[model samples]
Target chain A: MRIVVLAGGIGGARFLRGLKSAVPDADITVIGNTGDDIHLFGLKVCPDLDTVMYTLGGGINEDQGWGRTDESFTVKEELAAYGVGPTWFGLGDRDFATHIVRTQMLGAGYPLSAVTEALCDRWQPGVRLLPMSDDRVETHIAITEAGTGERRVIHFQEYWVRLRASVDAEAVVPVGAEQAKPAPGVLEAIAAADVIVFPPSNPVVSVGTILAVPGIREAIAAADAPVVGLSPIVGGAPVRGMADKVLAAVGVESTAAAVALHYGTELLDGWLVDTSDADAVAVVEAAGITCRAVPLMMTDPEATAEMARAALDLAEASR
Target chain B: MRIVVLAGGIGGARFLRGLKSAVPDADITVIGNTGDDIHLFGLKVCPDLDTVMYTLGGGINEDQGWGRTDESFTVKEELAAYGVGPTWFGLGDRDFATHIVRTQMLGAGYPLSAVTEALCDRWQPGVRLLPMSDDRVETHIAITEAGTGERRVIHFQEYWVRLRASVDAEAVVPVGAEQAKPAPGVLEAIAAADVIVFPPSNPVVSVGTILAVPGIREAIAAADAPVVGLSPIVGGAPVRGMADKVLAAVGVESTAAAVALHYGTELLDGWLVDTSDADAVAVVEAAGITCRAVPLMMTDPEATAEMARAALDLAEASR
Candidate 1:
């Protein structure tokens, strides 16, 4: 089977690992989210793309589910000592090489897509990883200050990594998405895909940002393959990360039925909620979408694989 | 006293330490060699400038006399793992920060001289450190390969660090130095100096490259200050490094008197040779240059400081 997955960072990477495990022979093409991509210390950092690459390539910090294993923060510390930093990002030495390589290649006139391919040449992530768009697109978050009540915008990383999403997000904007076209082979991948899956990633920033690119959403909707997704939200809470924070910025409730309705029947053919949120299945089916309730917690690889398998089964059923 | 010193890598850095100890209150301005600067992995690597900065800032790897003190090669190792390298360079994790900061600043349109000043803000090396020029100038060594006998011009770092100057150097070229103008403050520093000293650094690549910058040599020669130099060559060989290899390329014998003659009386008012090369005193003095024999070994800080004091004393005598 030829599969296409729209993914985010840690959660999306882990889901793809499970999907790869569940369908070993399937040719997977990952449309990685670049909304969270940041430039720190003048080096380009693609958090989502790297997460998927390292996870599948077996270089990931398995405990944390992102970045390289045995990573050191020597570079980060030294940069801090030099008083040059955002210092809040957990950019380890091993992770830094990727950024350096990527930045170097980008500076040399290679587009981000080509640079991603060059980097993947080392990792051999087993999936054709294409960034959603090579054009510069950054997610920014507007947050209100506690004491001053001052509204200010900052990079998504500052909101997520630095602020830990503690403050309420007033707005989440993908700064350049309207101007970006889907990367080369993205529309073709969707057109050629036998199965299109949306792993339990942040709908607002991950898969949502990918769809925000001019033709990507239209291509997927027009694709002959069934579009299936698993709920990142279970029992009115996120499986991991602060998905609720961003979802709220888009005025979406932190519930499986609400999220499914947010993607809507036009984009999603099949939607799977966790067994605990079985009530969401009927609510989602009421919206003219095929829905199922399964155990969605990625507690282990086997459990996550079972979840992936269920999504694939739902795709077949929806078709 | 206002003192100006032309410098190279490790030897220059060590000598500067002694110079600082010898005249703690002296207004010292160091004209650091930029010929040794190269782009490695697309990052600006100013090996000589970094050595001096780290040494004076108390961050140098004391044992190796270059790179960061408590350095790790995690970034280097990771870069190697990605197979993106000229893996021969000994860029440590902490040391990489300096380059990253420099490269970033340079990319953002800061001149190298300004970048150096900004970097010095953290190091506080206690001297005004300026590059010979704001423009790029890389020292390349022409050598014949062992088997193919194919002659090629490789970067100075490749010849010195990677090849260890194993093969004979056929030619030494300071690429881009011809068109380079002296960086701001370089000529002014020379003209304003009470005494000018050339520390025991590589004659060809270090001090030679600096002088190659347009108008700098002329500025030093026209300056009113007594210009004195300590020979990096001790007896008939270099005190350290493969200065002899490059010296031969320039058709200058690796002898204290020969190096002095190469600079000539036009440039030098006084010259200091190692006591072992005491016989060279007559040869250098006969060339219309004041010459002295001194213990030139930088075996320890005290010994090195004594050498610096002797050079200063010679400057006074020549005046």
Candidate 2:
């Protein structure tokens, strides 16, 4: 089976790990979300793409689910001593090599897609990892300061990683998504996929930003493959990350059914809500999508593989 | 007293440490050679300038006389694992931070001189360090492959560090020197100096490259200050490094007197030869330059400081 997965950072990476475990023989092509990509210390950092690459290649910090295991922060500490910052963004020595190589390639006139391919040459991440779009697409968050009531726009990382999404997000904008065409193989991958899975990644900035790229959503909507989504939101809250904050920015309720509806009937063919929110399955099915309630919590490898197995079954059922 | 010194890498840095010990109150300005600066992994590696900074700032690896004192090679190892390298260069994790910060600053439009000064803010290397030229002036070595008989030009670093100067250097060319202008304050530092000294650095590549910058040699020649130089060549070979190979490339003999004549009477007022080269003192003085034979071995701090003191005394006598 040829599977297509649109991934974000840790959560999406974790889900893809399960997907790989569930079907080791399957040929997976990942369309990683690059909207979270940021330029730190003049190096292009693709957080989600790296997370997936590191996670699958076994370089990942299994505990944190991102960056390299046994990573040292000597470079970071030295940089801080030099007083060159956004010291808030923690880039370890091992992780720095990835960004440095990517930045160097980009500077040498390679697009992000080519750079991603070149980097993957090292990791052999077991999947053809394609960035959502080769063109720059940064997700920015509009937030109101809690004390000052001042409205300001900041990069998604500052809001998510730095601010911890403490202030209410007024809006989430994928700045260059409207102008960005899908990276070369994205549309073809979707069209050729036996099944496409959205792996409980953030609705607004992760998977949503991937869909926002011009032609990507249209390609998926037109694709014959069943588009199965495992809800990032389970019961009344997110299983991980601050998804509820950005979900509110898009005026979507923090519920399993609501997230499925937000993706909507046109783009989605199958929706899987957690067993805790089993009632959401009927609500999602009422919206003309084939729905299932599964144990969606990716607690362990076996559990996550089961989630992957459930999604594949739903794809078959919906088809 | 205001002093100006033309410097290279390890040898120059070690001499400066002694000069600081010798003249604790002198205002010293260093004109560091940048001809050996090379772009490795897309980051500017200013080897000589960094050597001067790290050595004076108490961060140098004491054994090696370059790089950080306590450094890890995680970044370098990771880069090698990715098979993205000229792995021979060996930039440690701490040193990578310096290059990253410099590359970012330079990319943001800061001139090489300004970037050096800013970097000094962290190192507090005491002496004012300025690159020989703000413009790129890479030194290239012309060599013939022994077995293949193929003549090719390689970077100065490739010739020095990687090849260890194993092959006879056909020619040493400061590629952009003819077009390059002195960095800001370099000429002023020379002109305002009470005394100027050339450390026992690579005369062909280090001090020679600095003088190659269009106006620097002219400024030194026209300056009222007494200009003195310590011979990198002691009796018949260079004190350190492959100065002999490059000296031969320039058609100069690897001897103290020959090197003194290479910098001529117009540019040099005084010359210091090691006690072993006492006979060469007469040979150098015959060329209208005052010469002294001294214990020039920089075995330790006190010994090196005495050498610095002798050079100062010669400068005073010449003046």
Candidate 3:
């Protein structure tokens, strides 16, 4: 079976690991959101892309879920000594090499799609990894300062690393999404997919950014394959990440039913919620999307694969 | 007395250490050549400037004479895994951080001079070290391949690291030198110096490239101070580095007398030759440059300090 997955970082990477284990024979194509990509020390860092690459390549720090295992900070220290800017982000020496290669290739005129393919040549992630688009789509968050009435838009990393999401987000904008075309393989993968699954990833900033690209959401909606979304929220809170904060910016309630309704039955054929939010299933089903309750905690690969199977099963039952 | 010295890499760094020991109270300024600078993995690396900084700041590898001590290669390994360019040069994880910071600063619109100042703030290399110019002046070598009749201009790193001076250089050019201006404080340091000493560094590539800048050679010749050059070639071999091959490129013989004659007495008031080449002292003196024979081997700090003192004494005697 050909499966297409839209993913973010840690949560998505972990869930995909399980998905791979669950559907061993399925050919998976992942369209990763590059909205969180940041240029630091002249190297382009694609956080979500690297997270997925490392996780699938078996090089990820299982505990941190980001960066490589047994990483060293020698390069970071040297950069600090040189008084380089944006020292707040913890860019490990080993992690830096990935950015270096990606940046070099990008500077050499290769599109992000081609660069990702080149990086993946060595990583050999079982699934094909495609960036949402080759165009620059930066995620910017608008926040009002405590003392001032003026609002400002900050880069996603500034919001995540520096601010630590302390303030209320007025709005979250994917800057270039209006003009970004889906990478060449994105629409085709969605059109040919047997089942399309949205992992328990940040809806507003992660999967939403991927959907915002021109032609991607429309293609997924028109596909003959079943499209199912796993709610990132469980028990009225996000399982991980600051999804609730961003969801508030987009004015979406942090509830399993609300998130399912947000994606809508027009594009989504099935919606899977955590067992903790089993009561929300009736509300989603009433909204015209087939809903199922599953143990959504992706604490291990086995549990995640089961969650993946549940989404696939929900799509089959809906048909 | 204020002193300004022209420097290259390892040998120059070692000599500066001794010069510092010899005159601890003297305000010393080092004008470093940037022709050896290479952009590797999107980071600008000024080898001569770094060698001087690391040596004086007490961060240099005493045994290797370059790079940080106890350095790790995790970054390089990661870079190699990603198949980045220029894997031949030994850029350690700790060393990469320096390049990263420098590249970031350069990308942020800061001139190389200001960037050097910021880097020096952390290193605090007691002596003022300035690159010859903030402009990008890369040294290229014209070499003919054994199998091909065509000659190609290769970056200095390709010649130094990959070829290891195995090929015959048809010509050596310091690109961007024609329009390059002397770095700030370079001319002032030269004009205000009580004595000027050229360390036993590669003459053609290091000191020669520094002089290639528009106003630097003129400033040295016009200065009221006595200009002295210590021969890098002692007993018909370079103290360190591939000086002989470079000398051959410029059609200059690799000998204490030949190098001194190459500089000419019009620019140099005093010339120091190794005691091993005592016979060459008369030949250098005959050219109207004051000549002194001394044991120029920097076997240890004490011996090198004595060499510095001897050069100072010659400057005083000539004045």
True contacts kept of each: 0.84, 0.84, 0.98
Q: Residue B307 CA error for candidate 2 (Å)? A: 1.1
DockQ of 3: 0.78
- Backbone clash total for model 2 is 0
Q: Please list the residue runs of candidate 3 whose C-alpha ends up more than 4 Å from where it truly belongs after superposition.
A: A146-151, B146-151
Arranged by DockQ with the best first, the candidates are 2, 1, 3
Docking class of 1: high
Candidate 3 lDDT by residue in tens digits, B1-319? 9999999889899999999999999999999999999988867999989999999999899998999888899989988888776779999887887887788789889999888888889989999999999999999999987678778899987998899988887788999988999988999999999998888988888999999999999999999999888899999999887889889999999999999999887689998999999999999999898999999999999999999999899999888
| Best of the two (2, 3) by lDDT | 2
lDDT of each: 0.94, 0.94, 0.90
Clashes of each: 0, 0, 0
DockQ of 2: 0.89
DockQ score for model 1, please? 0.84
* Candidate 2 chain A: 10-residue stretch with minimal lDDT: A143-152
For candidate 3, give the docking quality class from DockQ.
Answer: medium
Candidate 1 chain B — worst ten consecutive residues by lDDT sum? Answer: B81-90
Order of candidates by TM-score, top first?
2, 1, 3
